[model samples]
Target: MATLFDEPQKFPLAERLRPQTLAQYQGQAHLVGKNGVISKLLQSDKVPSMILWGPPGVGKTTLARLIGNHVKTPFFTLSAINSGVKEVRQVIEKAKTRAGSILFIDEIHRFNKAQQDALLGAVETGLITLIGATTENPSFEVISALQSRCQIYILQPLSPETLVEMLENAQKQDEWLKKLNIKLKETEALLNLSGGDARRLLNLFELVVSAFPANQDPLVITNEWVLSTAQQKTVRYDKTGEQHYDIVSAFIKSIRGSDPNAAVYWLARMIEGGEDPKFIARRLVISASEDIGNANPTALVIATNCFQAVTMVGYPEAEIILAQATTYLAASAKSNASYMSIKKAKELVRKKGDLPIPLHLRNAPTQLMREQGYGKGYQYAHDYPHNFSPQEYLPEAIAHTTLYDPGQNARENELRKRLKNLWQDKYGY
Candidate 1:
């Protein structure tokens, strides 16, 4: 009996329940709350160009749409995936005709420098209020000029309470979903699978409900049902996209945090999702130096070997190599001292504008150079006791500065003692 005009039940649960206004929006209370910056902006007439940076399904696009609706502006949406520079120009040309228009670009981080540049004039001239949505870090992906013009607002993942509330709201608001006699017996599986993505959570919930037999009286949502249904509908992880970066980040952080179990879990996720083995290996190698450092120098060797092994062996077998490296890095005593010291040293060089190298430390390759006092007083450390000379090595301007602060780990502790003994109070070891 369904007519063309009749409400279609085929629409996705998430789409059907999409918030029409800011008032109905479920999460991001920090942004939409009474005194929040976004709320304040909405209260006013002016809608500034902004980039909403957050995880997937945190409602960046929804917020942009709500802002357009609230301001009653001509709204145009373009996806960075399919849209190019040509499309960007077309949109801007159309916006020029309208007095006040809002251009929303989803996955804006995917836009190339040239495509993003296309938006600069429109956003800068106030021809179109640009609202960009990105799941990736904008600093890395967005060009400086375009990024400078737009305000960045960070949206956090939906909390468990907020997610549950969203689910309840869907049941209450959606006529089709409301018709079912449903009870949520468990939510941990749903929450775990969603990974704080609101849209994915709703879609998974719908899939579970649809699995129930029509003759079944009460629809029971359990962890088992959710897991089974989810397995059948495999989780969509785009290895070349946002999820790739997210999983790699988690993997690196797990090792950095010294959680072998978590490190291995994320590594497995990447491997199973068919992520490039070399890419994962490269990150592992970086983590070995940056996070593990001098706490276990062997970690770098192991990570390097793992990378080579994976490159030679390839996947199926490569997963084992990656897992081995991941666990070793996680188990090793961690330190960022070496990494931080290099960063500080680099910063000093940049600030000091290449301070002159000390005369004593300079190499006197020829007689004329030696006559100019080059390497004149450079103490031979091998001739000194303990093969150590407490001499000035850094540029004269920063000679007294201590860049390498040894961490408190056992190995670095010994290093600290040695440096302290050699330098007395010179380097403040």
Candidate 2:
């Protein structure tokens, strides 16, 4: 129930100077430049339903307010964490009575399937322009029906230059800050410690500034003050929040990109953040199956066993099992052939719908099925020398549908050669 301004000691400069218009906003040049999407929308006097996807403290909530201001529409904000279906419907009904409305939902991914469905009717009929912000991947978190109705734009972290620029602007422009004789000695340490978070960087600057004795002719803001300020604030790491997803993303991408240094750095991040060892182990299992599949069949078994070991024996002992899996996965030859294959297969299903099963491959589970000539011409591969049949498995309508092309890694090179002997024409092996 405490107002932000009531707790200025805790809120700091960034919270105090949140941009009310797009013109005053910095960063996200991709979305708010002269010809940016929001800028163009302002020029045309129209705004569309949109979802802003990004990490924390990237000004998603501020941008929503900017959009509403530019369009001159009523802005109704909701947090998906607490707002329910009843609240959603009430907002939608209220939006219909207004000339135009922009419903801004923060952490929109927290909406369950039912809560999301409640917004469909209003969005479809243009009762409100919905702007949803989420830290999670919208494709996985948002309902497909709702996602299709909104244009998703990604926002990124403020670059070091941008963060420094903000600090310079505050020093030069802010009334309170300008009164102080603050001089930045070194920004490298501050920016690095801020971790590319604009809000944190600015708040740290204010802390160091306020800590200065009021009448000093030249207030020297050094790395030591910044470090000291950071130590006063104990950041409780949320295992399920921004840090968790960020660490896992870095960890997986590191293993995928073959950067052992980055992989281990993220591994240490997760461990220090107190992430569940079994959860890390499960990702390794999936990484082996999806990324290292077929390329090294042994990787799957190793990762699976590693997962079981971690489950049987919890941390800190499980950290060793995780390390062994991480090292092996990092060292193993990687291929995404199977991953791409399944993706392509799912896409084909969506595009082609359900194609008829080939009569030769259909099971003759009953007399009527056998009478329909099911399994009449099916060939048993076991009767032959090799356990493979040179027959088509795809539907007759799309008989030549081919997926699963092996990559040029050492393990997959052997697979490519074997596939060449098995099905020569499909892959040009």
Candidate 3:
């Protein structure tokens, strides 16, 4: 008995179908399961400030909302991208009248230090229980002081079982979808496109369904049809979530592989997708050292400068700078020696506990320590030719264990020659 709409008007399928209670929610059983930590806390009605870290659409926001609803207190929500310090203060002020209130901030990592600091006093005083959701790792993106006040719970990607179950439930639960008699004959293509994200899966399912005519009752959804229909959508690439990381990985690998053409191509793809310039710039800085390394020392300097320039100039012009850095790094000599060296060095330290520093390498500032022969045999490199004393700098137990084997590049070749002359095969350089 519904009248036809003159214009398209409705919430997204994801929103319309969002679970209002924990019973209807799927996935993230680790947190919502019977023996789960969050479940126990909710059972006790003890709500603490928490951060839910996960990839896109795995129920961070949904979980936060459910917790707020379960708490039976004043619930407020804000998006860090648009909400600032003033907005945060306003929420806190409003929550003052309601004790044990819950405030959920979606993409909380987007809030800068000052804005995050604004929530500290309210949270510290127990005025508002904060449920923050972030796609980025909290250790890197969150301020330490704020992070110290909150417990971080990692949400895993939705399993294939959970995703399929959602699809099955949607057809039976949604009024419009139920009438469509949607039959998912094949879901591999649809799930693959979702990348284990629940919201994406629901929205994508909506898109695929909308592609068919209304009269197409008992509509059959096949992998081939889903693929063909989805490919026809306006958006070519996803700018967030797993696809974002994949695109970034491709961009970095292209530069490391020394394909300037491909590197620039990937860089253009990221720029066109409205990627954060600073994020792309950061990857360039990492690639400069991790991929280019000492093989082209200037690559690091140029990349660092590129990051600075991009942060200052931003967009339109920043793309040109990113392109310059990307191509230069791709064209430059490549080496992982520096990257491998630290990795091997850390492994050695873990294998070999705190070994005593060689007596000569130990500091002898005090007269009593000097009597123990701390600096007795230590040779000062300044007095030696080429500033190379050729003494064991490492602990005696692991002496001469080669960690840095220069790459097979022109610059590293020179390094290999110099190391060979200095150690004379001592380090096997």
Candidate 4:
């Protein structure tokens, strides 16, 4: 077993154990099971452009490779981090001659608008089939035009059973592990550390095994042993990995929960971890409107200015601005009234689609529309007392619908009073 660790030096345990076939793959049964969408797609042999959206180390890259192999297509790989529009153009230029080629981009969300736009012509036309993998949500990260052309598949985290199976298999199948005769007495530490990532699970297993004596036959593994061995090895926070989302989640939840102390602490955690100042600033803007709203209108203003200020002043100075905004928002009066109002309004619109607008509320743009009684009985709010026209602006079918309910805060209480006095009993105020 002298070359046990040395043999797999080039290819890590995760890469070596990557699922070669759909049957060999663990987890995401909904996507690749007997009746899965991917199975059906493969049966028909009609592979379209797709974006695989999931967390890190969940076989996104592996699945992309498997798809290329199964379809017998020329597959090209690119990293959005180092590759830009120029590299993208080079791939496209080459893909022109090879029709039905597959171009897989790892961390596809990192591509900016211009870089994504470069792929539009090729994707729109059938020159190349794009397979984009990203950890971020495609709706927020990908350009709508490009996203519209690709089917998005979500890969879920590996289950505990699947993860355990993977570790056990790696130990038995690997030539080096067999030689070491490692005894896996317990796996709680490895599973907990993996955080449902299959690649991380295998990596942790390998690391723990390598630390033991070279000639130690029956190298026993246990929760306590693994934790102690790997604790000194692994980094607690990864800015580009799963820990990035966890810390940000804690930060946002602290703000929403109105704990300034926790909010500021989480903010420090982010800044220390090298998180993007703009990202923190953007969340601050969203939190202001979403959590504080009209309960403290100035909160939104402060957050907006914080975003602008951070954009201008980065790093050490930007941390100060972020902390200020985060604390102020956490301490402010909280309300989701405005956010809920829009959500309810959109839901109604979707459920009762294209509900005809009352002619009075509709704009009289042409003579024909005017003759059709558009704006015939429209009452201008400015012409009435208190600048409030007590007419139903919503369509007659959904008249008297109350969308905006003011929050029970000092500022919104005044708004509630004004609305109640104006609408009277008609709006149930």
Whole-model Cα lDDT of every candidate shown, in order = 0.86, 0.82, 0.88, 0.87
Per-model TM-score, in order, reads 0.70, 0.68, 0.84, 0.83
- Candidate 4 TM-score to native: 0.83
Ordered list by lDDT, greatest first: 3, 4, 1, 2
lDDT of 4 at 343: 98
Report lDDT (Cα) of residue 311, candidate 1: 78
Off by over 4 Å in 2: 1-11, 214-217, 232-240, 253-286, 289-291, 296-417, 420-429
For each predicted model, how many residue pairs clash, with residues at least 3 apart or on different chains?
A: 0, 0, 0, 0
Write model 3 residue lDDT over 1-429, tens digit each, in one string: 222222242887889888899998888888999888999999999989999999888999999999988989999999987899999999999998986689999989889999999999999989999999998889868899999999999999889999999999888988777766678999999898887778889988988888776555767899998889888542455665446766788899999899999999988888888887888888899899999899999999999999999989999999999999999999999999999999999999999989999999889999999999998899999999999898999998999899998999999999999999999978987
Instruction: Please list the residue runs of candidate 3 whose C-alpha ends up more than 4 Å from where it truly belongs after superposition.
Output: 1-10, 20-48, 70-72, 98-100, 137-141, 159-162, 172-181, 215-217, 238-243, 349-378, 395-398
Ranking by TM-score: 3, 4, 1, 2
RMSD of each: 8.3, 8.3, 3.8, 3.7
Count of clashes in candidate 3: 0
Instruction: Please report, as a residue range, the 10-residue window in candidate 4 with the lowest summed lDDT.
Output: 1-10
- Tens-digit lDDT string for candidate 4 (153-180): 9998778898888888897777666666
